[model samples]
Target: MENEEILKKSQKEISVEGTEDFPLVEVPESERKGFWSISVVLLGFTFFTATMWAGGNLGVSFKFWPDLILLITLGNFLLGAYVAVLGYIAYKTGLSTVLLGRYSFGDWGSKWPDFVLGFTQIGWYAWGTATIAILLTKLLNLPQGWNIPLMIVFGFAFSWTAYVGYRGLEWLSRFSVPLMTILIVWSMTIATKDAGGLAGILGIEPTKNMTIAGAITIIFGTFVSGGTQSTNWTRFSKTAFSAIFGSLIAFFIGNGLMIFAGAYGGLVYQEPDIVNVLVKQGLIFWGIVMLFLNIWTTQDNTIYNFSVAGCNFFRTEKRRYFTVGGAAIGTILAILGMYNWLIPWLVLLGTFIPPIGGVIMADFFYKHKMRYPKITKIKFQKFNWAGILGYVAGALIAKYSPGVPPLNGIIGAFVFYVIFDLLFKLFRINNDHVVEGEE
Candidate 1:
């Protein structure tokens, strides 16, 4: 009896310690205010839009246009709306995406999504660093060997900025927003001036593949994944309205404007890099600013989110180490000429990212009813096969769909989740009801 009692007591102690070690994240309630400005959200949107538009412009003008830009744009808008709604929820709840997901995914299950999110962020950071290095090398007539040192330095700079935390990132937002805005406008003006007028470019139909849907798809694909990051940033909002309005304005207007500008430039210049085209058109200053803002804004958020995901995945101390380590690895990859090699990876991400959004949207709006359980209790055994099957189905559909725009990933995921969730509930298998924080 004594030995049994000692074993039981020791087990209890271990359980308590484990529980204490994994304390639930506490997020303070956001201050309710009507005076919040939309500028911050707008700035974020602008950053995303400019990046996508610039990317698409390069792809379309240099290579060939895909057939579904407008369709992809519509898809992007729908996804953006969905993201805005989630952002509103996050602003209202003051929880990050990972925290919010705990309600539906269970505490342990959340790790998978977190891992994927973190991995993607690291990839993006490397891509951004590599892109800037390549652009700089070409602009300055530097040798290819310089890419390695430049990538390492740039990665460290971005990681350090992220280490300073959200304030540093917000400062980046404040600076990049107006700076990029001016550069976009100036570049458009110069491009138009050089092209004679906007009338010719606007009226001239792009080649057969460069349809409106294709342009829109490129825009949407660039930002479709942004929804995953919305909660991280929306936590700073003063109100739900601010989050919604700000995100929409920033994404739609900011993104649309950049695409328009790029299309205009495409009509005028035959160069592959939009910046190079602008430089050749005597808009070198604006081109430089756009390149800088593009690199800074994109990499800053990528590093920040990667740090958050890393911290959540590993020990607190090790999280920082992993983040820096990941950044370093990515930088090395960039230097090794992996950036050029990673287009397929980025495309894969574009395909896979949408399903995640679908799962998240379904869980947030449908399963959780837009309100998280107050207690952290999650039903561990009742692993919703619905979500798993739905995700798989969505992926298959996206993969096998014939000639569908890349945005089909989101569409597939959304449809599969809805159908599977409805079917699961209808069948009423393994249904259990529990209060928050109850395991």
Candidate 2:
């Protein structure tokens, strides 16, 4: 059969017979979603507590006006641009980060990404679970002993939406995004007013010091892991415009807003957590409401990423089972106290995850010329040594020689992947029998 006919039949089989999320194969065009659906879900995913905590860390160190504002804008802009590129790739190929990994990292080599991406997501899930429980106990004046039980309950409960899949995420996002937006704006307004408006806000002084690079790392690193996996949802995009715009809106604007909210609260109330800020502002009821929505939206998305990666790693079609399993692992971590490890985790995420995106971008745009063949049509190597070497090179540079680690990692990975690929090609030409799989 011709490639075109084979492609058509494969797409039909995918649309008609497979799981809705298309964990193992491409997302057929018929399963593609619209801009509104994509935007809100991505936005909800960005509305997370850990991001706010990162912002709070910045808030304590930087001035409210030029310093904090500029850092937030620059960091988020870089993040948005990075994710948007991946989103475009996802839209074009109809594949998630892990599926894309199979092409770049090779069939077996892809498990590295599956493990890294999946582990980071579970870490986030654990943090969220612990945060809500700890905060609720403090804010509602509940017993301290309830933290573990609350963690256990919310951990499993948040995975419910993810277990149901995309529709569940989309439906919950539709309901929660608007309400969260309204609450955020309202809180911002109250914060500004309480601080005596613009003049008072600008007059606020930094109580601590942080370098520009450090601040940017906190901002970018906070979400870089999750941003790398955003292809899970962006692959469902019906148009390139939807994919790009939704990514920018979420990673840049949506995430920046959460950062600003935390920073703004820190500047005014000397508190970074928005829920804590709200409580201080005498919005206790609204604070609880916001806490539940904010954590739930991101927690569900985080677990969904883990499930997708889990499916790819184990070569299974049972995404729902992985979702539940991920939640349980996260719950256990929360019980063991993953909440206090946020900053170091953020640093690690910043230092490592961007290289994966860099390798992916290189694989898609440079190696494949922006087109990927049907997965079934090609046999992959056990490992794409070029990609593996590139990742290692990028990670080392990011960790040891960084002005801005994430940016450094990305550039390093891209350049190194191409160089190594060329070297491998030359080697293969000298000994064709040493090479296997499609070039």
Candidate 3:
């Protein structure tokens, strides 16, 4: 009885220490209203959503190789729904993804997810910035290698915006969102008119170039990385309804519009780049505006999320430094010609992101019964071997799966984590009872 009392006391002390070690990010309570708007904008700027729609539509129209529109659409829709559920949890808890992971991954174990999330964001930032630079160079008829200089400028610009923290990012969203919407609508209007009509494009022959699996892969691959950063924006939502509505509008609606517009443009001009297609169709100004808006909105969110993850990792208040630092690195990489390297990185990111979602969803919704510890009194425990092993196994299967569906990563990860977690509990591994209010 005496030993039990001592053990309980020790647990309490550790919990207190953990709470002090990692304090919740503080935003003024009065700023809550703005957070909702910010969340909407952040979600709106997701590049993957736009890219998926555009790429998928293009694949569907050209009769390139295989047929997979339905499969791809299904995968994208399902994944979006799953991500929205996770966003709802984040909104309710007001915790970043890293903190949320504590429940299942333990304290230290959560770092792995953080590392993956951070690296992926950096990769995305680099790719987006480089793409924009290339576009600018081509549009202006700049000299060869002009992209190097433009990339540097873009890096600084985005990093500085991120340095201002959430406020700067919110401001970016305010401008970029409206511009993107206008561009999308305008592009569609012009493209549809030029193509003879939307109906004509839709009635075109079913393309056999892109397979169902390939389309699914493109759709899923686009947003897989965004899953890790969902909480950064969602935590600001004032209520669950806001989160769901905002995510649906920003993800589904925005993506669908972009896809339809891009498809129409492709049919009208046979151009893969939507902007180039529009330019060829005599809408150069609108094309440039669209490209700029899309790149800006997406880059802003990427930089902001990357900064937050960096701050968490270093446990420092110098968020601006990391933001600028990362941007500089990204810019240099772009200039040095590293954007091509992102294709493989994107593949890796997609493969890993789904497992994280599965593990996190399982822990919050199923294992913990949807109870999150109070932010001010949270605690961290040792590494969770079950989660680690499960994640690894999922990644391995996703990486090595022989010509499986493109979404094999998500499927494999979700399955591995759920099954392994249950098996670990069945074997009585790390089955410590969590004391209510202790952490």
Candidate 4:
């Protein structure tokens, strides 16, 4: 009787402490989410102002009929397929990117991913906070001095949903996704009419030139980091189909929409900023509303990613606390001006981040054979040199290779991971590998 009572009390304490979201373990089947819920949240995460800006750049560089359309379609298809595979892995493992890192990157090697993924997410959070504030100040004609103050207000305010965890994200997405869709479609309609429909759109010449490879790089790099971390939510999927299909809807269709909208605005008014495009369309009121909702949805998700990565890095279950801490740190960066660093930041993410995903996929599919032992059942090395070396090889290729950088990084990491893993096994260097298990 006493033993039963002790077990009950222990379980009760765990339930209270880690209920925000399971930062260190699998989400129970009972807590899994359906397709619609996962779709909306993922959609909300993909919809962002920066992605449109990337599209706008592409718009000015490629013709609409074939080049722009083809690039967007092809690029997003690859992006969607990549994230969907990761989503499926997430579903099978019920783990976030960082937790999965343990099996692949090793116990301490996982911290490298923890730091890389965490920094990228926080950088994005800072950029978003600064961007909204600057845009708001400009649109409202507020004093220049108000920029820092507004950033401070928004930096913390945007994290409210994230602080509440997955349920908070889902609730916000359910309300905001529909409205955001309507606004984007409405603005696109205006842009099409202003440009004189398809015929006119086709007639507009690209003002600049970009190589196909470069264009694709921009398209893929735009969200590689977010897609890499999307498992933070996709792990909640109720079924493998829900995880894969929902990722496709969000990364392919949802992100594609943002890009197309920005490209349309650029083609029509020589503007890529959607809010600015709406303003020119005489919908300033709706423009403000769209800006707020667009940034808020993505901002919350970005910070949430940071918190998840942070939890894994520190090996804590206090995800909510990290959410707040991350927001505060992002606010400080925003005040210091992360907005101006967008282009270089994207380049860095494009080069360095994809390899992490590649190593993870290789680790899961090859080494573990798509089945990971329970966390408690396995002992991890301080570093998994195969995964680490594989990532290094991939990142180097991404930086120096001439073809599509993100794709190069992913394939390079995957192939090298297999090669290195084999070498390690051949030499008995990896004898202490993760414990064997069946799915």
Q: Which candidate order results from sorting by TM-score in descending order?
A: 4, 2, 3, 1
lDDT of each: 0.60, 0.89, 0.63, 0.88
All candidates: TM-score? 0.81, 0.94, 0.83, 0.96
Using TM-score as the measure, the top candidate is 4
Candidate 1 TM-score over all chains jointly: 0.81
Off by over 4 Å in 3: 1-31, 34-39, 47-57, 60-75, 203-208, 341-346, 400-408, 431-439
lDDT of 1: 0.60
Q: Which window of 10 residues has the lowest lDDT sum in candidate 1?
A: 17-26
Cα lDDT tens digits, model 2, 353-411, are 99999999998899879978877666677788888889999999899884999999999
* Tens digit per residue, CA lDDT, model 4, 100-196: 9988888999999999999999999999999889888877878999999999999999999999889888888888888878888888888889989
Q: Once model 4 is optimally superposed onto the true structure by TM-score, how far is the C-alpha of residue 129 displaced, in angstroms?
A: 0.6
Better of 2 and 3 by TM-score: 2
Flag the better candidate by TM-score, 1 or 3: 3
lDDT of 1 by residue, 1-439 (tens): 9999999996775454333221234344332223134446335434742354344453344322333234434544664575677678767666667665454454556676678877777777777788777777877778988887888888787676566545566667777777777777777677667766856444444442444434444555555555566666665577777778766665666555555556556655644356566657776656666667766866766766766666565525233455577788678767766665443554565566666666666776777677755533444433455555666676676667754344566567667767877887788765233664554
What global local distance difference test value does model 2 have?
A: 0.89
Angstrom error of the Cα, residue 68, model 1: value is 10
Lowest-sum lDDT 10-residue window in model 2: 429-438
